[model samples]
Each structure stands twice: as structure tokens, then as C-alpha cells.
Target: MAKTIFITGASKGFGRIWAEAFLKRGDRVVATARNTETLKDLVKQYGSTVLALALDVNDRAQCFAAIKKAKEHFGTIDVVINNAGYGLFGSIEETSEKEARDQIETNVFGLLWVTQAALPVMRAQGHGHIVQISSVLGMVTLPVLGLYNASKWAVEGLSETLAAEVKDFGIKVSLVEPNGFSTDWAGPSSLHTQPLDAYNKVKSDFQAGLTDDIFGIPEATTDAILKLVDSANPPLRLFLGKMALPWVTQVYSDRLATWGEWKEVAEKAHGK
Candidate 1:
């Protein structure tokens, strides 16, 4: 059966790639972007199967309105891909108030608003899947991306709790945590803060680590996403690249070791 999918940030990157994949497979898509002009190709190519809408996810009203319109147009939205966020590049100390707040606004609050809007429709239909495009940074961290890391961490926490809350309504939540991908996520779509001399070495090392070998091709993920949405039982979290597991495993192991080492101190803090 063909499903109706609502995807944000469909102008390019993973959102556009997945939208095209779904349309190719006969799924109806309500695709949105801040600039509808960028989505014209999808509309032209897919015609009636694709509905392109202009949306700025940071606007709460636009988020609600877009979802409502999609529900009305598609009759039922089987899946929602909240992929409309960008990365913020900067160290914690170097980040400005505006930069931090804007990051939160789009990556955190925007997703929350969209999720809130979809809950009502999904509850009424009694079945829907919501996929959040988080990052490996959600589970681990990298230097010079503290704000982006914080945003994904917020997304991870939010989506996990949502999965538990909406299970009774037949609404599913999944966080697609991708490792480095050859998407404009790190290019034109991202925002960077002014660098401080104190952190030049950190920034340089971070840039040095961005070798072509680390990034997976963006289009290669379409099959994985399709399978995820098609599954009768989907995972609460899905990592989308080779490096995600090893990176997360190492981080978690270190975390566990430290916690174990301080188990007595932790218990003492919990005083009877």
C-alpha cells in the first residue's frame, strides 16, 4: 500500500532525497521548505503525488498550519519526517546568545511544534509514524559543535518520551541519527559563529577530521528510511551510517565506566 508522507525541509538534502524516493515508490508526499521555489522540481516531476508547501519551521503557526493542510489534503498522513533543522558550528564559549537561541528555535522548538500539531491528527487516525532527523552528536559530541550537539540531545530526549506517550494511540516515534553525510548540512544550510583565537586549534582539528571517507552518500539512505517506515515494528532509534555505532559504543562504554567508578559516591548522594 502506498503511504502519505509529510516531510519538512524538502528543498534539498535528506528531505528532498527521501521525498523523491517515496514518490518514485508511489507514495503521496506533502513536502515543505522555507522556499517553495526550491521544491518546484518535485512538484513538476511527481505532479499530483507531491504537494509542495512553503514553511519556516521556526514559526509555530506555520508548523501547525502546514500539518493541518497536509492532513486535509492527504486524508491521512502515515508518516512525518521532521528534517528541517540545520547545524550550528561553534564552541560553547564562542557561541552568541542569538546563535544559541536561533539554534534552539529551529532544531528544538520547531520540531516540538510540528510534533504537537501531528499528535491530534495521528491520534484521530490511530496510526502514524514520526521520524526525527537527529544526529550522532545526540548520543556523543564533537568539538566546535556544542550548540548543534545540545539541539540533537534535546531532540533525542523529546522523541523518546513521545514514543512512550503515543504508543497507546498507535503513533510511533523514531529518531534517525545520521553520522556525517555528504549533505549541505555542513555547508550552506549551516550557521557558524565568529571564531575566538583561543579556540583556533579546536576548530582546525575539527576541520581536519572532515575527510571525504567519513561522509556517507545522502541518497544511499533512502532504502533504510523506506524500510523503517514500512516495518510493523520500527525502532525507537536508528543510526544511519557505519561510524555511528562504534562512536556511540565507545562513548557509552566510557560513560558506564565512569559511572561505575563513582557508584559509591552516586549512592551516597542518594542518602536514605
Candidate 2:
């Protein structure tokens, strides 16, 4: 059966790839982007199967309007991929107030608005899947990506809670945590703060850690996403690169070790 998918940020990168994949497989797509003009090619290719809408996810009213239009167009929304977010590359001290606030508003609050708008429609239908496009940074951190990491962490927590809360409504929530991909996330889609001389070495060292192989092919993710959307029992978290599991495993192991090492101190602080 063909499913109806409502996805944000469908103009480029993984969003465009996944939307094309779904349309190729005969699914209905309600694609939203800040610039709907960028989505013209998809509409031309897929015709009526694609409903391209202009949406700035940061706008709550637009989010609701888009959802309403999608529900009315497709009758039911089987899946939603919240893929609209950008990377804010900057050290904590280097980030400006406006930059940080904009990051949170678009990445965190934007996702929340779209998710909130879809809930009632999904609840009424009794089955829906919400896939949040988080990043490996959501679980760990990078030196120059403090704000970006914080946004994904917020998404991680929000989506986890959403999964637990919406299970009774037959809504499945999954976080697709991808490592570095050959997306323009670091290019046209991103913003960089003015560098602080103190953090120059930190930024350089972080950049040194990245290699060509660490970046996955964006198109290759289409199959994994398709399978995820089609699954009867989807995972709460799905890592989309070879490096995600190993990297996250080490981080958790170190965290557990630290907690265990501090167990006595932690218990003493409780002081029953």
C-alpha cells in the first residue's frame, strides 16, 4: 500500500532524496520548504502525487496550515519526517545571542510546532509515524558545533518523550541519527560565528578529525529510510552511518564509567 508522507525541508539534501524515493515508490508526498520554488522539479516529475507547500517551520501558524492542507489533500498522513534544521558552527563563547536564539527557534521550536500540528490528525487516524532527522551530535558533541549539538540534544529528548506519550495513539516516533553526510548542511544550509582566537586550535583539531570516508553518500540513505517508514515495528532510534554505533557506544561507556566512579559521591550527596 502506498503511504502519504509529510516531510519538512524537502528542497535539498536528505529531504529531497527521501521525498524523491517515496514518490518513485508510488507514495503521496506533501513536501514543505521555506522556498517552494525549489520543489518545482519534484512536482513536475511526480505531478499530483506531490503537493509542494511553502513553509518556514519556525512559524507555528504556517506549520498548522501546512498540516491541515496535507491532511485535506491526502486524506491521511502516514508518516512525517521533520528534516528542517541547520547547523550553527561556533564555540559556546563565540556564539552571539541572536545566533543561538535563531538556532533554537528554527531547529527546536520549529520541529515542535510541526509535530504538534500533526498530532491531532494522526491521533484521529489511529496510526502514524514521526521521524525526526537528528544527528550523531545529538548523542555526543563536537568542539565547534555547540549550538547545533544542543539543538539535536533537545530534539532527542523531545522525540523520546513524544514516542512514549503517543504510543497509545498508535503513533510511532523514531529519531534518525545520521553522522556526517555529503549534504550541504555544512555548506549553504549552515551559519558560522566569528571565530574566537582562543578556540582556533579547538576548531582546527575538530576539522582534522573529519575524513572523507566519515561522510556517507546521501542517496544511499533512501533505502534505509524507506524500510524504516515501512516497518511494522520501527526503532526508537536508528543510526544511519557506519560510525554512529561505535562512536555512540564509546561515549556511553565512558559516561557509565564516570557515573560508576562517582557512585559513592552521588549516593552520599543524597544523604538519607
Clashing pairs in 1: none
What does the lDDT read for residue 61 in candidate 1? 94
The segments of candidate 1 whose C-alpha lies over 4 angstroms from its true place after superposition are none
lDDT scores for all predictions? 0.94, 0.96
Instruction: Name the candidate that leads on lDDT.
Output: 2
Query: Per-residue lDDT of 1-272 in model 2, one digit per residue for the tens?
Result: 99999999999999999999999999999999999999999999999999999999989999999999999998999999999999999899999999999999999999999999999999999999999999999999888899999999999999999999999999999999999999999999899999889998988998998899899999999999999999999999999989999999999999999999999999999989
lDDT over C-alpha atoms for residue 244 of model 1: 95
Candidate 1 local distance difference test against the native: 0.94
CA RMSD, predictions in order: 0.7, 0.7
TM-score for predicted model 2 compared with the true structure? 0.99
